[model samples]
Target: MNGIIIGQFIPGDGFFYKVDPRSKIAGIFFLMIAVFLLKDIYQVLGALLLTFGLLIIGKISFIKVLKGLKPIFILLIFTFVFQILINRQGNILVDTNLNISLINIGLVIILFVIWRFLAKFKKFNFLLFLGFLFGSIFIFIYSSFSFDYNLTSFNLQIYEKGIEMSIFVVIRLLIIITLSTILTLTTKPTDLTQGLESLLSPLKKIGFNSEDFALIISISLRYIPTIFDEANKIMQAQASRGADFSEGKLKEKLKQVISLLIPMFIIAFMRSEELADAMESRNFVPGKARTRIHELNYSYRDVLVTAFTVVFFAVALLFRLNVLGY
Candidate 1:
């Protein structure tokens, strides 16, 4: 939870920081579309490179971007592995007999021990986990060491296309994640609220309350870290009371989760109630006209960014349609 960076903002004086929030928001949307339109490996790689450049322009380090991705590292790996396992479009690359035996189990245990030993190095934890995952997988795939008694046996097949698709999917995910991280890192919550409100204002003709909707989004993003912190505190309190959430059976884990959720829901209600009271105390009203200290205005920089993003997205669309021919 602490690793999450989607809603968090960091103070910086960079190109993106100076750009209008509306422009940044719209640019990000366009770039996201561009990323999704990417079909070829080179095109995606090019997009990744552009994202890196944007990171530099935003004055955000690659390490910080990687940190933002730490929380979803496992999800990416699972996605990659799933794609590899389910894809059967190409010839088999690795076809081997995997066996479950005493030696194999011990080796896997040792690998886990090593991973735990290296857990203190927080910076490269994701890479370590990746290594552990692939290491265990390879151990099972090879099964080089085994006892006379075998517990189970199965054949593992890895297709060429699966590897290709997995890489593609993981890269696309990385690009999207990094792009979003860039946006949140550079854009302030209030600015994002205003930007979204402005962009969504057209919905007012349809009886939609853009202000309320924008406020909701802003509040949700603002509270993500708070809620995560609350969850951590709850987890720690539970741990102090002999609740082992990490090391537990499915039933025990579920019980622990319920215990955590009950308190979380209570806290959420309390927070909402407190927020409502505070707003009422300040004469806050929903669906009311409001004035801002800083009015949003588009400048030449915003125009340039919009144009560049539109062009980038257009090229990506063309590429996706095979009109560009790579």
Candidate 2:
């Protein structure tokens, strides 16, 4: 329940929350495509701005997004160093090809800190060290091979398959993740499940029942927190029972955790069985003649969001194909 998972919904009806979840899903896809299609720095920055704007409009705290992103601090620094050090043909901020020194690498890491971590000191420092460690490891290995380019093992073209463009890809992915979180944060889980069922009704002809899909969504959302709470409770209960896990040898404590797994498994199994029997007794069946309690009425906002996504996708395609760039 720590890190990104903590960014889970607190259940509020903010403006973004009132917006339909389906719209949120569409918006995320559209925004991600716009971000991903960029080949220039300008486009990336513009997309980032738009994402933040949308989040603010939804009234989501930027800190929540950053918290979700904290687990990836190591990777962020790795990408930063990859850009600063390996991509160092443009400027000579440092010649730390032999040893660590300030080049574009330092500034690049700073940019990551600002955008991703903001004023979070711990995350910033953690990423900086991670970047340093990555740079050191690479330098060590490369130097071990040879200082001369002639002895280089293998280096591929930058755009051959987009490996060199991973930083941009990751940033775009962040937009998707953030927007998804914002969607869940804003939208009610029950309303979202109902909307999903309605949206998928047409698929019933193809053998997918809206009710089952709704149930799936409902159960999945319901259990995410249940599992988290269950684990936490287990920890507390074990603690109260005098099970000391924080101390003792790692193997010993892991074994202690193993001692808890069977009981957890049995409880989870029985709970699930109970849920199934309840559903069965309620005469739940797929493709039944069940009506939606809440109807989905698309307002101007949904239309606007949809139109914006289409235009953004077109723009992204054009940029990718070099039309806009040209």
Instruction: Give the winner by TM-score.
Output: 1
- Candidate 1 at residue 305, lDDT? 88
Off by over 4 Å in 1: 1-6, 118-131, 145-147, 215-288
Per-residue C-alpha lDDT of model 1 across residues 1-326, encoded as one tens digit per residue: 66676656888888888889989988888898889888866788888888888887767889888889979988997998899889988788988888877788888999999999999998788689879988998888776653346788987789998898899999999999998888888888889889989998999999999989987887887788899999999999999999998887899999999999999999999999999899889988998898867789888889888998988999998998888993
Mind giving the per-residue lDDT tens digits that candidate 2 earns over 124-149?
76556656556545653344323333
Candidate 2 least-lDDT 10 residues? 151-160
Candidate 2 TM-score versus the reference: 0.68
Question: Each prediction's TM-score against the native?
Answer: 0.78, 0.68
